[model samples]
Target: MSISPDSTNQRRRLPGSDAPAQAPSGRGLPRHLLGKLATTPTHPAITVGETLLLPLLAVVLGLAFAPQDPLLTQAAFPWPWLVPVVLALRYGPLAGLGGASVLLACWLGLNVGHWDVFPQLYFLGGLILVMLVGEFSSLWQARARRAETLQLYLDQRLEHLVRQHYLLRLSHDQLEQELIARPMSMRDALKELNQAGQDAHGAGPTPQQLLRVLSQFCQLECAAIHPVRDARPQAQPAAILGACDGLKADDPLVQQALRTGQLCHINQAVSAQQDTLYLVAAPLVDLAGDMYGLLVVRDMPFFALQQESLQTMQLLLCYYTDSLSMQRLAQPIVSQVADCPPRFAFELQRLAHMHRETQVPSVVVALEFRPQALKQDLPEQIMRLRRELDEVWPIEGPERQVLAVLMPLGTSGTAEGYVRRLEAWMQHRSQQSLAEAGIFTHVLPLDGAAPLRTVERLRAIAHA
Candidate 1:
């Protein structure tokens, strides 16, 4: 899951540009003012609090600042005029009118039974002005708030769409890399096969090894590699190779893929009246382009959007089958040689252990090489090798650690010989580069009887 440089750059820009539409209005408001506004409740309680506070403050100020004159009293009758207006703007016309009524009542109570003391016309006029202003302000504020809310919603939707688009793109890139990596695995397998072909005697992968590789590459729940038998299509069941979960060889999709030499996509299948959806099947074609058997995959949920991805995966599987065929053609030649590295020998021993334990024919092989030379002299060699290997063989583990190699399913007898050829090639290269560079080679035995502890094994090898 390495992020592309472009994606990394996009992520960097995301934090700064998030909610760009809201930026303008948000920036316009002072931080303290925005904070206070946010805390202000949307209920009428806020309006009531404002009305009570403003009038009381205004009356206190008036008593201290203004002389007790009849003219001043008349002018100051609507002393807390701003309170009702604020209440109306925040809580609507009804709230403003109610607040004004309460203030008016309070004023009348103070000047009750004293018509001469209070100018009734002036007081009435002040109350009417407050109500009018409050209502008008409230109407404008309500409209503004509605528009703002609509704009915010639109912005959110737009951002969501943009993020989805980005995720899709990211997923596409990942798929491409996975597809590209497949061929590289095949190429590595081919390299082993080619060397085996040239060596006159070597060993090669077994069917079980191939199945394990396929399972790893496809991220399958289980993989069954069956030998095509000349029996009635309906009667023969595919053989189970490497499986993460327990699945019968007689599964419908598995049987279909084996019989037809065609990829089967089982969207759903009924198992005990339970409809199970999302499955894929692919055919294994050897290097000679001969259809061997079907690669049955189950329990994977496929979406419409993942059609292209699934198709690509199928292509990779086909390529793997072809590479396996090529390796088979080269195996007899390589098997005659007994000379291989200790690591390769250890792998062979492990494969022997698995064969005895599981009663399944399997073998382990290793490709030893100097990565630095490949990187320096053949800059595109890695990519080339990746493309080739992925076509025929799926990688067992991390690509960074192992170059390209194939583990053909159901392979036996000559696996060690195939590994020996690869070892000899590495030795030749190491000797050739000894004058100018330190050349080191490491062998990894896949399908060994011991558990495939990738990190620990690689670490031990590096230290060794």
Candidate 2:
């Protein structure tokens, strides 16, 4: 999810305050004193140790350097007051109060025999002041801690909301692109359909991909594509395709999508099973406006089914249907290609290039045999061939086909020589297999730079 800079900034603002507070520094004595008081101990044990040690040291200092004048007793002076104030500044009111109490007790004990050493009013006044400062310091520290915690929580929530907003924006942009590039050709539709099939066969499209598209297009959730069966007497949905939140392929809403070639908006279809607010079914139609299948989406927001979203939904349905159709048609050939010796596919591609370069006749040699005939042993053989080919000639194409150097940079005679070598290689491999598999080669003569005809010829041969 992409977060807009403004939204991010807004979210990061200090909690309970619009602007961040500047750190307190020098100038005013009370502000400085307050700042000192706010510094809480990071470690509880450290605060406790300091509280224990300071009062003990104050008592020893008062005894070791006792004042002779009773009116100016050292124990009643600043030393006793300073120790507790320091404790309060460092660890807040509790530590300050505890430290002050110990210092006051020590002062009274040390001067008990000399009544003139300290005045009762002087000691009482200093103790009260120290306690007040400690309590105030603690209150300030508590407020600051609470503010910091609240700010952190607000920052996290804001980040999450921003992320979600960005994702929705990105989805909107993608939908816009699809709309602009609409009225897609049959070939493009087929290509998209093929890609979807490949994704399904491999790892399947992620929920993000499905949901983002559905939400953008305002599609119904229960739509799916099913294979036509011969003996079942009724068509069964083959795979669960795209869907919105709570709708599944088995829902009656999906059957509605299949039946109507127009947008099917059924509010409260699954309100009993789930809190379904709305459902919309759009037909997947080709450029010719021929219905191929249906797209079912459920629980979509009312605003999502606007005309623009509905149009995008129609386009998505068309694209998905075309992909499914192409996959169905290409499956047999792809299976056959997969079963063939891995090197053979590469050799065929190489042969195509050789035909173009040499302007000589070249053929795509394929071994014809049903997969069931050699199913037990073909997988191991294919795996071994794949590894060997990867080591020798690792070439990839846009179509994801394996290609080899069958007729490299060669003359007409070189082309023929390569063909004979390939034939010999096939003959040697055929001896180990007991199937109706035999090497069948189709030759095509390239005409000038135009390899289209040659390509068509090779395709025809493969089809045959």
Candidate 3:
């Protein structure tokens, strides 16, 4: 993703500085000199040049103006010490000390006998001042680098999200036209795939059905899906669509996909490829890096091989892998809590996977109502109270009715707003507080903890 230079410069601007924060560009003398003075030097060669240049320039200027006193000892402001101070501010203590050592060398070689008395105080004061300024420079420069790094990361993340959003909107618009021909949106196809995965309590559809769906959505004229064994694509194809030859494990595209664990196509410039067997090679991998299979496409429409189609194919493949993985991941929760709906279990597992990968928190709020509360249709009412983004799973029991609300990308603080909204609704509808209505709330934040423990805790709450 491309970060805008204007935005980056805006972000890089430090307080009290009019010019933008920038690294040394190592260009011509003026820019290079200004950049080095303005920013900390990252290149070792620049540091060496800077350390030597500043001291030598100071000595040359001192010789030109005060030939007898090259150290500028008789000058009003002790100008010779300014070189070390500038070096210190530019590249920290080491460069500053190096500059100071040069001046010290000049004093030892040229002025040791010229001065009747040793100028210990003059050298000591300059050394102390350089060290202090160098220390100060080191701390702030370190802070500036860290800030820039953080800003760069945030900018890249923002760019990625923006691009993804744009693609999502474009796909949605295209899906409208595609629906007339295919009778399915990407969301609908994914839902069907998810349902298929949940069939027979998580056995999922076979590879043949998977390839059929991919052919339908991605317009794969001829393709084969081969099961990967021991991190390698097997020779025999698990599922084949249209005319297909045997699997070529040595295919360049296939090898590229295998090595990178990503989608690779004939158009990629990773290697010089005058000839290739397949048009596209996509690894059926999930966020957890589990390789389910390798999909190699031999033929596709000229128009259908664009970015949208390729991304859709990869997305569907990832969704398929995640669905199968979710089955295994949700098994323990389902086994423990038989009342948990398949959809709820799948979503919980997916959220846990998201949390692990991105550290994005999801919340599960269990609202338990008294047996009498059910008469008011509390579970149903609370179910209606869920946000559009929330997924509600209502569990009914003899003594208590529980409504589990899954809030994706929510935090404890945000969940409180939801609870507050629920409370307000309850007060208006039933004219009673939660305690009076005999409803208790339990919150579980999915913050990288084992999701099984959450299910176990919920099971205990349900039984209690």
Candidate number with the higher lDDT (1 or 3): 3
**What TM-score would candidate 2 get against the native?**
0.29
On residues 1-105, what C-alpha lDDT tens digit does candidate 1 reach at each position? 432334222222221123321124355647788669645486666667766676555555656776453123556355555556666666666666666666565
Count clashing pairs, candidate 2.
10
Model 1 gets an lDDT of 0.45
lDDT ranking of the models: 3, 2, 1
Whose lDDT is greatest here? 3
Q: Residue by residue across 1-464, what tens digits does model 3's lDDT show? A: 43233432223211112332222446655656666756655789989987887788888888898888888775677888998998888788998999999988887777656667557878899999999999999998877765654454345334334544644675688876778755467877677776666675666777887888888887888999999988999989999998997997787778878887777777652245346799889888754568999999999887776656776777677667756775677677787776676557866876786677556678999898887777777787678777755778776666887777888678998789988888898789779888688888999897466877776676667777
lDDT of each structure? 0.45, 0.46, 0.75
RMSD of each: 27.7, 27.4, 11.3
* TM agreement with the true structure for every prediction: 0.32, 0.29, 0.54
As for candidate 2, its clashing pairs are 193-323, 219-297, 220-296, 220-297, 221-244, 221-296, 221-297, 221-298, 346-403, 346-404
Worst 10 residues of 2 by lDDT: 387-396
**Candidate 3 has which clashing residue pairs, if any?**
none
